[model samples]
Target: MNLHVIDTGFFKLDGGAMFGVVPKSLWNKRHPADENNMCTWAMRCLLIEDGDKLVLIDTGMGDKQSEKFFSFYYLQDTITLEQSLAKKGFHPDDITDVVLTHLHFDHCGGAVSLNASKGNFYPTFKNATYWSNSHHWEWAMYPNAREKASFLKDNFECLESSGQLKHLDVSDWIGNGPFPWMNILFVNGHTDKQMIPIIKYKEKQIVFTADLLPSIHHIPVAWVMAYDTRPLITLEERQRFLPEAVSNEYYLFLEHDAHHEMCTLKDSEKGVVLDKTLSLDEL
Candidate 1:
């Protein structure tokens, strides 16, 4: 199996929100903010070429949103998702599966695009099945007040409307999770039933650390995101997941960090600290 890094683009978000309770005195040193107090973050996705399945992990925020809507995020893209996939010798229709970690705009927005021919939104990969868990699907369908803004209907409403969306069953998640080489980790701290994909690549296990562990800086269990609905649950999730990551020697594939692509964590005297930073090619 081969894995490809799909970088759709970068955008900005308030550093305070991204770092949660971590003070500017500390996080500021790691991520400098602009005059607007927004830190740039990458909307990095992943592509998996496993036998006949050409699977895409996440789609960066799509371009269908209104200009006013995008101005808030300061989105910038050097290459389109189509171009990124073309560089890897595949097209949108070539994709067989799309694994959505959650239904947030940045994470799953690109799943749908405005069809120029139809004057409406439609699934981007017409041939692929869009993957999202049942619980998350419902949560996004009816988002809470705190998360409603992040769960934009235009980003994903087309998937199910077009009959291409598939809700992966998590009830039997512990039963090897519907994939032979990939396992799903259900985390609820960030959002309801967020599915983190742990794929067996090369000789090591690669964990697609979505929002649960957005960047290497988030390795410190206490550095949870303020966007999390339940901050305490996030702390609990990190406390349990970090040690297991170290023991299993899993490589974390970061999705939002613009500076770092992937990183390995080691159990230091103070707890899990980044051991090494590298790109997917190093794997």
Candidate 2:
């Protein structure tokens, strides 16, 4: 199996929102903010090429939103989803499975796109089966007031309408192997039943830390996002997960960090902290 880092692009978001209640004095030192206090973050995605299946973990925000809508986030960067896939010698059609960690716009917007001529929404990966658990699907479909803006209907409804949406049973997530070579870790703190793919690769375990651990700076137990509905629940989930990640030496694949691509954790006096930083190719 071969793994590739599909860097969709970068976008800006309020650092305060990203760091939650964490003081700016602390987070500012980590990811410095611009004059407007917006911190740039990468919309990094992962691709796993295993035999006949080319699985994409998450799709970054697509370029379908209006200029006025996108101006809010200040999206930047030259690389795009199509270009990133093409660099790996694959196309959207080559993706057999799309594992959506959740239905957040930044995480799944690229899954569906607008067809200009037809004036219709369609799955970007025309042949891939888009995967999301029933619980998260329902959560997104009928989004709560807090998360409604992030859960855009256009980003996901087309997948279901196109007859390409598949629901994974949350109950089947038992033992170490839920989906052949990978196990899933579910946490409801960030969003209900958000699935984090724990992939086994080359004698090492690589975790796709989708929002649960957005960046290496978020390794601390208290660095939960403001976007999360239950901050205390997120803190508790991190307390449980970080120790295991440190003990087992898991290579965390960050989805939103701009500076650091992947990182390992170590047990420091202050708890689990970043041990080393490297790219996917270095791993």
Candidate 3:
């Protein structure tokens, strides 16, 4: 099995919001803000090539949003989804499975695109089966007051509408897959039922750290995001996942870290600190 890091591009968000309860004095140093007080973040995605199946995890914030809508996030950098795929000798239509971690605009927005000629939304991966959980699917469609704006209807609706959506509930997640290396674990707190894929390749386990660990800076458990609906639950979730990662020597593949691609954890007096940072090629 081969894993590829697909970088869609970078965007900016308030550093304060990204690191909940953590003082700006600390986080600002980690990710320095621009004059607008927005810190830049990478919308990194992963491509898993196991035998005949090509699976992509999380599409970055797509380019379909209006100019006014995108101005808020300040989506910069030109590394587009199509360009990234082409670099790896694949195209959007070549993806067999698209595992959505959650339906947030940044996570699943690139799953669909606007066809200029048709004037209708369509699945970005024409031949792929887009995977998302039933609970999360419902949560996104009928979004609550807190997360309504982030869960864009155009992103989630296009998948099912195009007959490319597949719901994977709690009962459906078995570690072993049709492809021997891939497995998924569902966690809540960030959103309802976010799916994090754990890939077992040879002796190493590499987990796709979704929002649970957006960047290496988020290794400190208390450095949870303000966006989390249940911050306390997020604390509990991290306590469980981090220790297990340390014990088993798991390589964490961060989605939003622009500087570091992957990291291994080590227990410190202050809990888990990043042991080492390296690219996927190093593994």
Candidate 4:
């Protein structure tokens, strides 16, 4: 099995929103903000090459949105999904599975794209079976008022329209075996049924952190994001995930962290903290 970090460039979002309830003085030290108070974050995705299955996790924000939308997020240095995959010696057509952590715009937008001529929406990975949970699929389709804007129809529709949308129920196992190498963990604080993929690689367990732990700075229990629907539930979720991470020495693959990519957790006086910072290559 091979894992590669797919860089889809960066975008800017309000720092305050990213770090919910945490004071600027605290989070600012970790993720410094720009003059406009927006912080630049990497849309880092992961490509898992296991045998003939090339799985891409969480496509970054695609370039299909209007200029007005891009202006809000300050999308820049976008390395398209196609370009990033080609760099790994694979084309979009070569991808066999796309495991989406969630259906947020930034995470799943790149799953679909405008045609070459910008005429209509299409699946970026034409041959991959796009994987999304049944719960998340319903949540995105009938989004609540708070998250409605984030659930863009173009992003979700393209997957099904391409005849490759495979809704993974709560019990779908990869390769259909008693002991699955790839296991899915579900968390609800960030959004309903956000699936985190836990991969057994090199006799080690590496978890794709997704939004549950956006960056190393978010390892602390109280550093939960403001975007979480239920902040208290988020606290509980973190408590559950942190100890397992520390005990198992799990490598966290961050999605929105600008600098640090992968990190391990350790118990600190204050609480759980980052043990060491490294990239995926180090693993």
Instruction: Point to the candidate with the largest lDDT.
Output: 2
**Candidate 2 Cα outliers beyond 4 Å, as residue runs:** 175-178
* Residue 87, candidate 3: C-alpha displacement in angstroms: 0.8
What's each prediction's clash count? 0, 0, 0, 1
| lDDT tens digits, residue span 1-283, model 4 | 8998998989998999988888999889988999999999989999988878888889999888999998999998668767887888888889888899999999999998787586888888878888887889989999999999899998877687678888776667555522267888889999999988888999988899899999888888888888888878889999999999999989888988889889898998877888899989888
109-204: candidate 1 lDDT, tens digit per residue:
889999777789888999999888888899999999999999999889889988888777676656645567788999999999999999988779
Candidate 3 per-residue lDDT, tens place, 15-81, comes to 8899989998899888888888888889999999987799999999989989999999999857998
Number of clashing residue pairs, candidate 2: 0
What is the lDDT ranking, best to worst? 2, 1, 3, 4
Would you estimate the TM-scores of all the predictions? 0.97, 0.97, 0.97, 0.95
lDDT of 1 at 117: 77
RMSD of each candidate?
1.2, 1.2, 1.2, 1.9
Instruction: At residue 144, give the lDDT of candidate 1.
Output: 97
Clashes of 4: 1
Q: Candidate 2's residue-wise lDDT over 103-136, tens digit each?
A: 9999998999998899999999988988888999
Candidate 4 wrong stretches, greater than 4 Å: 116-118, 173-179
